[model samples]
Target chain A: MAERAYIMPIALRLWHWTNALLMILLIISGASLHFTDPVIPLIRFDIARTIHNVSGIGVSVLYIFFAVWNSATGSWRQYIPELKGLKANLDRQNYYVFVGQLKGDAPHVVPTPEQKFNAMQQLTYIGVMYIAMPVVIVTGLAFFYPELAPAQLFGFDGLLPIAVLHYVAGFGLTMFLLGHLYMGTTGTTVAGGFRMMITGWHDEHDEKPENEQP
Target chain B: MAAIKTVIWAAIGLVLLTTSAIAQIERKPIAPEDLKNIQDSNAKCLECHSEGGFDTLNREGVDKDKLRDHLVDLGVYEGSNHGRVECKACHVKGFEEFPHAADDKKQINWCDECHTRKFLRIEMQFDESVHAKEGIKEKFTCSTCHDPHVFQAAKYMNSPRDVVRQDNDFCLSCHGSDQSFEQVSKEARPDLVENHEWLPNRPLHWNAVRCVECHTPVSKKVMSHEILPAEKAEKRCVACHSADSTLRLRLYKHMVSEERSRVGFVNSMILNEAYVIGATRNVYLDLALGIFAAVVVFIIVLHSILRIIAAWVRSRRNG
Candidate 1:
């Protein structure tokens, strides 16, 4: 049966869009600073540095708000990957993405208010939000206030290793974003996922089987 | 009649001498512009020295080892900052005639004569330096570190890298080599590398930055010639790496202006020019990020291609 569900709330949608814009700005400005010579004219080195720092602080604040909001709404559970259905979810998701979709098979998982993300999506988001983002943010702050940080950490000079960690985390985050963008296109229509994210609802008819029509 | 004749002769002699003196005073004075354009008289000395000057023995027949101390490399001197100035300007009180007297040949140049006004502040600071306090000032004159003829302003150096190279080279010329070290310090000299055990990556640090950057105490927009003791040298990495580094106050003050604010996190514009190890952003990190993004894109494209091929084969088999 075709169903209609309000998976994303207005506040969540607003936070998501703002976070996305800030992440994009941070990445661009950080890139400009990293490659200083033959400067990116869109934002000069000084301006880019200012933007990167400001956006970093903005993203940090937004991340805290996201955590608080997720906890308040009891929606944080959606990102926690449960071991009970993990293997089956992974197998079905993999088959659907790699082979079944090619053969016109219906998707195994449907979006609901309780479980908005599939097992793969849940795992990926957990790593990005909890691991990558935190590492980058902490290292960035350490770099900003080097005086307070230890001169050496784990037998290496703190700042260089911290910088490397931040860079590597940024790389991981960038890859996650790429994968996220590609996965968005795998919906019923190219823009269907984007529309669902913008509005709070997803039309179940897009993925429902024709033989099982209500 | 004899007395009157003698008086007439004396009067005539006096008048003739007075007229000659007055005529000498009326002679044309040399124009200041002409004096400026006057050729250096030291060119005569360069005639023999310009060839294999330092390699040849002195007129006093000093040994080859001691010959180097007496002989000047004319080629190097000719290209120096003081090349145009007459040697007699500094080597005054001697060399009025060729083959100067043995005692007069040892005349030392007085730096204070011309530099008193220009270098008064530096001189004052130098008087308070460890070198002066320890009575080592006589051993290490201006020429000990800076060769007046060859020395160029750090600002006019080809690049920042070149400035750093020359500055380190000047310091290492004495500290790094035994021959030069013996000339300055009578105390048993410590091995340059061994003495710097506290600094990690010592050679790399030496090559990348000026010795004065760390050794000299911080002064506003200028390198303090009053070098600090080795124990007092700036050893902390945060001194240069932090937002409020003294590097901004001294070495990189020119980069800071009204455009840059202390509130701006990236007020230290020196990071734009050089990769300051831990402090500045690096190109290698950018390259790695780029490669990671490319690989991700490739994976997505490959998966899409495989999916399209699989779909085509399945449809053909069904038909």
Candidate 2:
């Protein structure tokens, strides 16, 4: 791949931060609702519902905008993983994180606009957007209208299965957040990814070309 | 701009006039249609309750949690048999206008208004029965058996399967356990389980001998302005005791209690309460966990498939 530079587009920047912040908020409030503590009720468990509801709207709206921008601008194609070198690149990234960087390696394959995301990032984001979010929303609807649903809640005659599905979706979202937090630290510096998400500008690494054509 | 301002001011004044009329939630005959308009009124009940209330519990932030609290309140309400009665049926003259300043529920008398026959029956029966007639301190009111307002059957556990799942918890509030009934059954007659083998021979299966089998259902249907005397209460004892020895032994070896049921029997009632509640609660927790797990597994599988497809397409394009 040729040396290239691609300043993160403004729309992409906004969507990224909005999605990241909203996901964090969801995990916090969702955790609090399912498992609350005795002390420090910044807001009561009742308000966890409000937080979950409003933040859910925020995340979903941003997701719609992000999807539209990706499709319209044809940037969604960038997520396509290199089938042949996927294992090699993933291993290279892992080695850099673990011990290779300490022993002074060239960090395997160089980062490029064509392959902006590592294999893991592509996989995680795809699942969160397409699968996990819809499950959470549907389960939430189930909890809200258990009686008016396929059946009444107090009776086991029907709708018992929906209730169980609701909890599994909740726990799944919890697991997603935990893994997401661990991956967040893998940027160029100690707090590089955190800084980039906040300001929408990762510190320009000297070795890699900054200018990349779309 | 000047003419538009005048029209806008007039509209604002007219809106307030309409709202003031709607605020009187005590509007009588609170039909289903009225509830929609009531909810749409945009009146914040929390505005006053959170700051000013006779009881601090109904104060600020009260309305925020009121929805969940309503369900919890239903539990307490059922325990008192007030569970059967509707709140507004006794509250204000109308549901919308339910007076916020007082305890409207307890103020209205239940026996004279709703359960006159059962009330009169108690008065007539007590004279010849077990209690010391004059000095019986524990007064049994109309609600002793029937809660005229909120009276409702447990719809969830109204089935045999639901009852069996919960075992005895559903009706434990009124009935005792099987073990408790065993002691009473021994006193009445031995061969407790073995004798009652068929459908009719179950534990605590007392035959209806004296208790009126066919009576009009007593709901809260009060009618005033009639000078005619109300129907008299009836106590037809010996429905089973006097039905002749041969018939009595066929149903029971003779444990008929025209006076009162054998002691340690109320425990059996509580056991039925357990069955319904236990069945419903277990169903909820189980179903909640199951779907929750399935959704997760489904998402994971989908994610893997999508990942493989995306990678394959990319490699083909490159080739």
Candidate 3:
């Protein structure tokens, strides 16, 4: 029998869908704002700005709830990368996705609650949360303030650090997101992970191929 | 013998008049001084032109340089409506010699020589126009608006007068009545012109978004909100929006756009106000929004820090 554990939680699934939908909206509006000059996709500048801010605020609320739940349940540990033999595991992961999977090698290890993400996946998700998301939100706020809000908050001097942090985070987020989408598709089945994301469970009864290749 | 003597005297008089006419003459060209032997004196030319050559007087002691430069200064005259006429043709000699006296009749023009019917028609119209009559403002001569010598006046002033008047503000200068000029500018027309006394028609006025949110596209980083003035914002959102305009300016925030106070966002308002403060100009939007943003960030950051601390404390307790 294929091994399984307490897979994705209902609460986690709710958060995931909400988060994804909001992000799609944010991306549409954000891309509209980013590619402002060419005048394709997004029709109006002000409309783009408004949509972006609203999506940001929505994400803000959703993240607050997610953070609270994660902290409470102690499930955030799924993201903390293991320190021992991390590099070799990362190498195995690289090989599995890039080469070994095509040669029918078994996965390095089956996913468990404690070892849900591989070293690379753990690092990438952690990087996004700790660095990327915060920075983008901060930058969006800075723009709003510069465009429409007041000047004297924690003082003019504090805003510069905030602005710089935002840009750095935005760039990091870009790199992480690009990599995440590319690698996310390479799970056990072509749509295995995506199916789990939608239905909250992977099928348990598929027979192992005598010469299994990804 | 007596008849022949009379004829001789008349002939002598005719010769004298001809030489005098030739003495005080100006042609299409000035006297050609191509040769060193010729003397082209400006004072003599100004004598008849500045004063009355038809009378006995001309301008007194005109400087040679000033007279020579008059050609450049008065060069526009060649392009004028009276380009064909010689100066002396109009400054016709009265019944006088070179040192003749002035009579008002000497300055008169022979209107019959041009268009007889049009001249009389204009004279009747002139009596009706205030300038032609007793009123100083209404009285405008044919030469008042038009430069008889040079028609270049319109060329230098950017565009024709009508187009300048067609400007958003320029048209409103005279047309504004019930509405404040600020409202007039913001509104497309007429409706903004209507809002001076009354607030806008509530439902119609309520739908429009704030002006700064849409119209001003200059990047916020470089936006110069340094010139706020005492008069109030001409570009404010409510100006163009009235129930009356055919296209209809929209107001109010929709599902996505959250427009706020217009003046607070508009750089034009800031610049006008900063004008009085002289050197000190500050944009509050950058800082205020900055602060608001920081507070939100700080809260999230504080939560994250607390979470980390609580986790450490719990682990310590367990250990």
Score candidate 2 by lDDT. Answer: 0.43
Distance from true location, Cα of A15 in model 1, Å: 0.6
What tens-digit string does per-residue lDDT give for candidate 1 at A117-160? 78888889899988898998888777566545454333223455
DockQ of 3: 0.01
Model 1 chain B, poorest ten-residue lDDT window? B18-27
Q: What is the lDDT of residue B219 in candidate 3?
A: 27
lDDT of each: 0.66, 0.43, 0.44
Worst 10 residues of 2 chain B by lDDT: B221-230
Model 1 TM-score is 0.50
Candidate 2: which stretches are off by over 4 Å? Answer: A1-6, A36-43, A102-106, A109-114, A141-148, A152-166, A208-214, B1-319
lDDT of 2 by residue, B49-110 (tens): 22222234453433435433222233434433343334444543432442343464455545
Q: Lowest lDDT 10-mer window, candidate 3 chain A?
A: A149-158
Query: How much of the true A–B contact set does each candidate keep?
Result: 0.19, 0.00, 0.00
Per-residue error for A4 in candidate 2, Å, reads 9.5
Ordered list by DockQ, greatest first: 1, 2, 3
- What class would a CAPRI assessor give candidate 2's docking? incorrect
Off by over 4 Å in 1: A39-42, A152-157, A205-214, B1-108, B111-289, B306-319
RMSD of each: 24.9, 25.1, 26.3
